[model samples]
Target: MQTPSFYFSRICNALKLAALVCLFLGTSPTWLHAQKSLSNELRAASEQFLATLSSEQKALANLPFDSEWRYDWNYTPRQRKGLPLKQMNEVQRKAAMHLMKAALSNQGVAKAEAIIGLEYVLREVEKRPENDTYRDPENYAFAVFGTPDAQQPWGFSVEGHHLSLHFTVVDNKVEFLPSFFGSNPGIVLPGYVQEGKQVLKEEADIAFRLLGSFDEQQLKKIVLSEKAPNDMLTTNTRKVSLEKREGLSFGEMTSAQQKLFQELLTVYLNKYHVTLKNQELARLRQADMNKIYFAWMGDREPNRGAGRGHYFRVHGPTFLIEYDNTQNGANHVHSVVRDLTNDWGEDLLKAHYEAAHKK
Candidate 1:
């Protein structure tokens, strides 16, 4: 029997193969229009998860859909407002994971779990006590903005150290953006149970490949600086704007480089379930690719063995993707994908509210 790792490792290849099959068959994936089905599943899983929670837990897990806190998101190991896994019992924890599985693709779920598990490695490296609570795998908090309903607008988020994932559903359409996935001890060294584990390895490696393919002239267009930023430029902001566009646009890339760029994008987009994945990819495909920009900073090489820092971002009309590995001697990584116009499902919410007012 093949393990989950086997399938996880094949995500990029599978995506490429799926694209080829789509082109050959002249039909979209069967799950392309499965948004409503996914919405129903999310509703059911959320209901079940809520059912397992006590009254106190429910109070913490549920929030008004219009609450300002819905936009309050972070990937730091700090106190959060949602119901943490540490507060859940065995049954409740299982339900929580079911909700996660409902919202994320297998690859996305694996990355989240792996990021959480890194707490153990970090604790060991820091020589923390066995009972230390600072570096904890169970601190991830789950919060539901508004009740889960099929027709009404609602949202869900699961966040904690190195992970902040948000999803919003309205009128059967789902939006996933302003999503963050990070890794500390990004590459686990030897002397650990899962040594050499890099949860966000593809996110880093793909960009490296694209950068290496560029010639000196090509590099000048994309490379922003020799020093990487200490953190994401847009760190946890509620809104994202496309300011002065900088870096190399897709129109400038050669055919081969463009292929690498698209593959790099698929690594992030395919993290969602097929429905959301196809929906977002279709929208991006329809956008003007010439306007999409790729910028780089810091070391040309990744310096995998604790050396210089590096950072890059893919910014376009509809979305933005930022990746940074400038902390902890470039051993920690932070990557996020944000929607420029519809983050937190603002576009849907605006339309929903506007229609209601008209009614």
Candidate 2:
């Protein structure tokens, strides 16, 4: 009856004692007023959507709103939201989707209406010819760093292809860690599965019931360096000192494997914001839950679906969560959550932009 990480660990202990005075006046006035009000409303909706482009639509609908277009995913977030809806026309793509629905959340406005339904699957399979539909969810690019209005610190990202989202709202108290949620043809079968079936499969059935409560040599010292480690040990690399917490340690499991590893890392620290998912499970209960590691990989056999032996991963110390249906057979899924020092807490947004814009 009460789970979703036990109401996200009781709303992360009342939002970590309501941000204990900017965590003892260290910074965050609501992330510098949601990063100066979302950098002045998406830089004035990217300067009125680049004053209605037409120098070849301002060299193919401009860019800089995002750095390296959120690590380019070979396009298709509706051709990156049609490069600002093809350089904005319908009143500047409804004023940049009303400044991204006033800074995201009708579930981030259904991820920009699923990138305009992936731009009608790239204008109906990019005019067929064995059409791959020339993928493009605008490579899922959208960024607003430091300024919106709720907690003075701000970030909203919807990165490419299979999509990733990161949300931060520090001072007002809401941060969804190193958050990345992915799906590639995760069930877009008959014309967008009519918005019903999203097959992450309870993110791989709660990590195969927490790695079937580990035992075979505690799942071989947390199944390290197998395959799934290429891109997210908080890939944004914040300095947990890249690898070598040397896997497996929830005090070396078994209290029913630490209650299925705290109900599968409280489904990724409660997908954030119950006071930073209770100050990251009170920092894994002050680093003593018998250390903490619950790793698993490539088809321990789940209807052998995550493809190529269907991989899985989960790491610990204030969290890292991952899932892969190994390409597409397990019905394509990629999951991510990291707080290995608040990534995109980009060093707490460069120490609140050097103690308030070091003028």
What local distance difference test score does each model get? Answer: 0.87, 0.53
The stretch of ten residues in a row with the least summed lDDT in candidate 1 is 23-32
How would you encode candidate 1's per-residue C-alpha lDDT over 1-359 as one tens digit per residue?
A: 99998998799777886674563322654543466678888989988999999999999999998888889998888988789999999999999999988878899999989999999999999998877778988899999989999768998899899899899998766888889999998899889768999999998999999999989998898989989999989999999875867899999999999999999999998788877776677667657778889999999887875779999999999889999998888899999999989999888889888988899
Q: Estimate each model's TM-score.
A: 0.90, 0.35
Clashes of 1: 0
Please list the residue runs of candidate 2 whose C-alpha ends up more than 4 Å from where it truly belongs after superposition.
1-134, 137-147, 150-155, 170-178, 181-216, 220-247, 250-291, 299-307, 315-320, 329-333, 338-359
TM-score, model 2 to reference: 0.35
Candidate with best lDDT: 1
In model 2, the worst 10-residue window by lDDT is: 69-78
Clashes of each: 0, 53
